[model samples]
Target chain A: MPSDSHEIVTQVYAAKKDNKAADSFIEAYMPFIRSETAKFTGRQPSQSDDELSIAMFAFYEAIRSYSRFKGAFLKYASVNIKRRLIDNSRRERRKLGVVSLDQPAGDNEGSSVLSEIIEDKGRPYDELEEREAVHQELAELTERLSVLGITLSDAAENSPHQKRTLEACRKAVDFARSEPGIIEDFLRTRRIPLSAIAQATGESRKTLERHRRYLAVVLLIFSGGFETIQEHIIQTLKGGAER
Target chain B: MRYIVAECHPAYAILLDENAELVYAANLHYSVGQTVESPVLMETEKTSGNRSAIMHTVRRAAATAAACLLIFGAYRLYMGSADRSAGSTIFMSANASVCMEINNKGEVISVKALNENGEALLSGYSYKGKDKATVSDELVELSISYGYISSGDTVSFYIDAPESGVYDSYRTELLGRLGSYPINTDIQKYDSSVQVRSDFTVSTQATSAQPETAANSTQSYSSMTETAETPAADTEAVTNSTVSTPADEQQAESAYPYHDPETYTGQSGEGNENWHGSGDHGYWYEESTDEEENESSTSEDTDQPYNRRHDWSDGYGRYGQDDDDEDICQYSEDDCDTSSESSWNSWFTGWSGYRFYSYCEREEVSECGGTDICTYDTGRDSYFSCEHGTECVQPDDTTDETEETEKTENMDETE
Candidate 1:
């Protein structure tokens, strides 16, 4: 199996050199071409879409010309597909005036060819009901912790209460999030490695060991995935001083 | 992360297969074999088309050139006619029977005589003068002293043609050539008592060179006295009078003979008598009118202190001396008010204003600190222990605030 981009590109070039092999290679990548064209055209492209044809031709051209020095063959092919589709769009725009979506359909009365429907995605409501979002995130966190034989409630119970202790735990969590290898190890093993955290944060091992599960949960929130819950918690921590 | 990355490839494969069905595979395959044409080569091909259109452009250029030449020729003809219209007047003398063309500048363009002798002498000659003439030939200069005279103010040579016969007939033939404009018959003669008098004056001027220097020296002396005793502004006017040439002073003296300088201090009734006694001489007529007006206006001020002294100096030398006492008094009051409030300062500054010292010069001598310094500090500085005293600082703040208030008031007044 090809491991690197260079091996993949070399194989594609070799396949294009043979007429029979080139046909199979182009046919195999045809779905990939249609998907990239759809990404730009904002819908599933059909046989009638000129952008699909342009993207396919660009992919075929890329297979013929791509070299190992250019890095990834898929990336090179995607770039060519995008560029050709844009060029076709510009050409069509000059040749034919843009048809507005609001134009009424002749065959159907009281119906536009393209409807003006707005999709909200409920993002603002998520921020407004921040408590519900945090509770939802905590449920997901409990499920993730269940695999490690630890519950979300146990992590919360172990959380530092005194201001100085909480600050020390936050320093260890921040260190683990910044150092990707530590976070990756924690995620893979479902455990906080106390020695690494203590060495990095200069906190005593016993203190970090005691708060390790809480630090692990905080690290998970900071790293990725839990964006809304993380923002709410940071705001809470900042307001904690007033309390 | 590994699962997400793995899923992207499968998703891409599905997208490509979906789009590949939309593309006409045969068309895509054909296009893949073809190469794109170079943009540089296409540009060169476009330039080749420009060569084929060159002959069509040449015909257009030739047509435009012909039109430009036609317009230029018409403009030249219009300008030529305008020049001819400028110098086209001809005057004919009724009695002399001589016709001549005179351009706007009064130069003789051409001369034609009706009588034989006049015709013979003036056939090729041109005279260019108001009251002077020149007679010459193609070969030699005949006379430099030859002259012509015209009637009234502007000269035109309808008479005084070059020949001896033209000179003899000038009084009789050209007496009425001036047309309804009454001209003295004596002026028609080709003779000159006036010119002789002018020549005598020139000769006398050449002979009396020493008196010119003596008059100039006296003028310089008078200007120095004016600078020392009167305001500096008066010295400029006095210097201008003193610097006049001896001929100018002679003209002044001849125009208005010496009158009692005191007569100018009275009303216009008395002043007009002296002006008329001078016969209102030609150059001084305007000066006499101005003097008459001055006397009438300043008659009321005759009793004012220092008024007679100022008026006496003005009357003694400069014939048309300006009245400067009012300006002197105004400047004196301004200096006293701005620099000091003391009675001593007021009296001394009032006299100093007329003594030919500029405000800046007097300011330097008397230590008059300008608008910036407080007047209260002038005589009181020696009495106070501190150099400027609190009076100086307090008034500066008051003065600045008042200045701002005054500026706003002035802006309001303008609006």
Candidate 2:
């Protein structure tokens, strides 16, 4: 019930995503980022005033790329701050026994060195993606889903949406399982047809028509994607026969 | 990897290869990594807990990754939400990203990024650069979703009048207010942007809107406030629980055979968390019954009330259900948008603390469609991450509805 920050964050972001303007935005928000970063105090290296500076750069980039797809800018920016902070900590630890030197009042060593190091490390533009980590995260997620007695097949087979679309569909399926009347109530209350579901789910109507046959076994399967699985089986069997 | 004794550690410890020339032999310290033998070892100390812990962490991560690949034979899968409307109008929603900065000057500010639980996502690393320092690990990967007419509206309703002109320009705005994460003590701010590329088939009647203020507010309030309005759902729930008359029994009979709809009468889940145990269907294109079972399984947990139908009572439709009573200022005119605009949107953007925004310059240039179209239409529990904490790497207390209500009440009393 919190007042939505989505509008403000999204608007500010959309209004200034240009790479050319990234610097000005970064400069204006530098103070705010410094303040937010400063809140970390003892946790960060002692000799680092550049914390705000680094966080600002990240914030600027975040401003450029934030979107409705991620929910709200507040939520997204908070995540960004944490990420930048962690990297800063890691880099500082790698330095001399200073592990991480907290910047003394007048010492400029921290910022200069940090800037030099950051510049050396280069842009992580494409490195942001860790295929291995993502894969691991996915496996862990599906494993958790499995604990509920639902297999990936039982979940994803329900709808043939895109990979991301499949993720959304799975959430819907997961929610449906926890609620008692969602399935019947959804159809009756919203007047949404089983076929119309293809929009969110990219499943074919023909596939849906075929799978509507077993509305009971789904309980045994513990997932909503039985129809999709059935269609797969049918296709496989036909293919096997053809071979 | 050459061994060199650097400044931090005393005696013969490992020295950074690059810094060797500068600190080469400031003291009698030998290079850090090469030879384990050194006089400094005579007064050595015990290994610290910090080093061991970091090593353990690396080991655990490697093990987990290996185990995952062995067992599941697949990688991580990120699910996206479809309860979208922000991109219904302007700017192409190309992508969404989470970014951070790194430099020596930046390390001091890293702590604020941690979730209340104290976990860091974009941790950093060090390397040398040319002209300027550029931190790498602090990544910001964008979630770029292109909204194309996946499938046109099949059940088309006739546009009453001379609604002409193709949809050449459109913009969308999204303001999420689902409150904090598991570790976030304070409410985390979520930023959302939406862009849609449309090929609008046009009709002739110039689309016009009839702005009715009082009625519009009430109607908008009812529609926008419907999901957030706790009373409506609570009343339905109460009606459902008390309906035990003979007529009610007959009504139950008239209700769904699979689900006793009338037994609960008008009992709609208002403040309750909406769950995977849906009232109707899950994402499966067809009803395979298994999906129904899954739905029933998750529905029994009472912890989540807003899972089914969330009440926007926390705040109005302005931005969210709480705190923001003053609606977001409406900026429907083009002239107002020309001032100081960011580089992303075309200087024509505005936000008044809530969840609404307007892009077109002139009010008369294009009549607002259904000027009073104020209903929030997407299922509250539309994603997997919300229900089982699947994709939530870190969560917060306000992430749930029960705590939000308690907090809201506490704040109200204080005020």
Task: Return the top candidate by TM-score.
Answer: 2
Q: Which 10 consecutive positions of candidate 2 chain A have the poorest summed lDDT? A: A212-221
Interface RMSD values, listed in order for every candidate: 36.5, 25.2
| Model 1, span B215-256: residue lDDT tens | 222222221211112123432233234333335646865764
TM-score of chain B of each: 0.20, 0.12
- Stretches of model 1 off by over 4 angstroms after superposition: A1-132, A236-243, B1-415
lDDT of 2 by residue, A1-243 (tens): 332352254244433433334445555555556656766654442223556544554565456445444566656766776676676677667665753323343356444434334344544543233323333433443454455444332332232222222233333343444654656654345322444454445544333332231221232223333332223233322333221
- Which stretch of 10 consecutive residues in model 2 chain B shows the poorest summed lDDT? B78-87
> How far is B87's C-alpha from truth in model 1 (Å)?
99
Clashes of each: 17, 161
Candidate 1's TM-score: 0.18
Poorest lDDT segment (10 consecutive residues) of candidate 1 chain B: B1-10
Q: What DockQ does each listed candidate score? A: 0.01, 0.01
- Among these predictions, the greatest lDDT belongs to 1
In the range B307-353, model 2's lDDT, one tens digit per residue, is 12321111232212222211211322222322111111321112222
